[model samples]
Target: MTFTEQLRQENDDVFQKIFTHPFVDGIGRGDVPKDSIIHYVKADFEYLNAFMKIYALSMVKAKSRDDIRFFFDQIGFVLNDEVHPHHNFCDYVGVEYEALQSSSLPPTADHYIKHMMHHAQTGTIAEIYAALLPCPWTYLEIGQELLKTYKPTKSHPFYEWITFYADEEVERITLELRHRLDQEAQDVSQEQKQLIKEAFRKSCELEWKFWEMAYICETWPSEQEASRI
Candidate 1:
């Protein structure tokens, strides 16, 4: 099996947890509260900004023109293509996309972004890819899983979000990145490979936490609560 396949197999438990999470179930059922999704969209909008920065870091670290181009394409993908779902969410809930731009990253998103930034700043390209892989990869998996049981139509509140991630074009693009990571892994040392696995695992764990955060509308304590603590 390929490296991506191996990573997926090892992290299946976390993926299963994400698949069964209340946030995901709610999305599939079309009953997730607007407040929860709004919280998630605002946080994720900030997260996507950090994601682009990490890709920029990776582009700087890339050795070859092709590698640089890959990162460049991905940054463009996130900037141009990924935001449409957020727009859809905003439209459904009557939130302005511009407002999301100014929103703070919630705790879970902050942690996940920091995790990827750490690897992007200090790790090898393979490790950077490993760190970043789970975001899009798992979304693809979630979309696939949701499709198996839920048919999203125009009436579905999350139809755009569900279909955007589940699109054949998106699956194709995501798998291309997965295959690229596997190729990057082919020549890495065993120690580096372990680091890659650890990065991948942590990101997978964080992905699940992200869903939980949105489900509960997790946030930082208020100033008074923070001062007391």
Candidate 2:
């Protein structure tokens, strides 16, 4: 089996759970609360900022002009097309884009961003590819699968959100990342493969928490009033 296929099989539990998660399912049924989506948009913008930095690092660590070009193409998509829908949705929902820009990440969002940054800053090109594959890959998969049943009509509350991930370009990027991961995995030791799998698993778990955080409208908790004497 291909490395991507193997990774999917190994993490099937999380993969399936992510697809069935209410935040995702609610989008399918057009039942997602506006507040939930708004909070999620705020947190996700921060996630994308970190994602852009990692893409820059990926370009620096890339193996060839082709790889470099590929990274640039994907980065452009993220900055331009991928984030465009957020602006429209934010406006329609009465959320200010500036507020999203200035908003702080909830703890779960911060944790995921730090994890990606660690791999981008310190990992080998192979390892970085492994670490980053799950985000776009899994999101693209979710979009495609969701659309199989529910058409993302223009009237759907989260239509912009749904359409962006399901776009052909996004799928292409996801496939490119998977191909990069599989190619790099070809020469790595089993230990390296284990490391990649662990990173991917942690990322999937973080992704789940991200949606959960928004569903519950998470924010940093207040400090305790005082310690008991």
Candidate 3:
């Protein structure tokens, strides 16, 4: 099997959990709570900021012009094309898009962003690809799988959000990333391949945790009596 295939196989358990998560299922069923989506959008907005930064760092580490352009184009896609989903969520729920810009990162999101940044900043191109693949890859898979089971009507609460990720462009982008990672793995040492594997798996786990974080609306505990620090 190819490297990308192996990565998917190894992480199938986590991907299954993400697919079956209440947040995802609710979106498919059009019954998700607005407050949960609000929390998810806020946290995910922060996550996307970190994601773009990692893409920039990957551009710096990229060995070929092709790889650099790949990252650059993806950054553009996120900045220009991906906002529709966030807007859909906010507009439906009566929240301003601007509010997401100022939202704080939930603890799980913070950890996941740090995880990707660590590899982007310090790892080889191969490892960086491995670390980053899970986001787009799994999201596209989620969208595709969800789409397979239910076709959202225009009036569905998450119609735009679901269709956005299920778009052909999203699938193309994911396949491109998978191809790039598989190509990068072709020349790496065995030890390097292991590092890539580990990064990929950890990222898969974080992907699942991100949904759980939103489902539960995670936050740091209040220190009510310590106001005057």
Candidate of highest TM-score: 3
- The CA lDDT at 105 in model 2 is 87
> What TM-score, over all chains together, does every model reach?
0.94, 0.91, 0.95
Q: In candidate 3, what are the lDDT values of residues 1-229, reduced to their tens digit?
A: 9989988988899999999999889889888788888998999888888899999999888888988899999999998888899998898889898876868887899999998999998899888988988988888988887788888789888888888899899999989989989999999999999999999999999999999989888886552235445
Residue 89 C-alpha lDDT in model 1:
78
Poorly placed runs, candidate 3 (over 4 Å): 222-229
In model 3, what lDDT does residue 127 have?
88
Model 2 stretches astray by more than 4 angstroms = 223-229
Ranking by lDDT: 1, 3, 2
Q: What is the lDDT of residue 155 in candidate 3?
A: 88
Per-model CA lDDT versus the true structure:
0.89, 0.82, 0.88
Tell me the deviation in Å of residue 111 in model 3: 0.4
Alpha-carbon runs more than 4 Å astray in model 1? 222-229
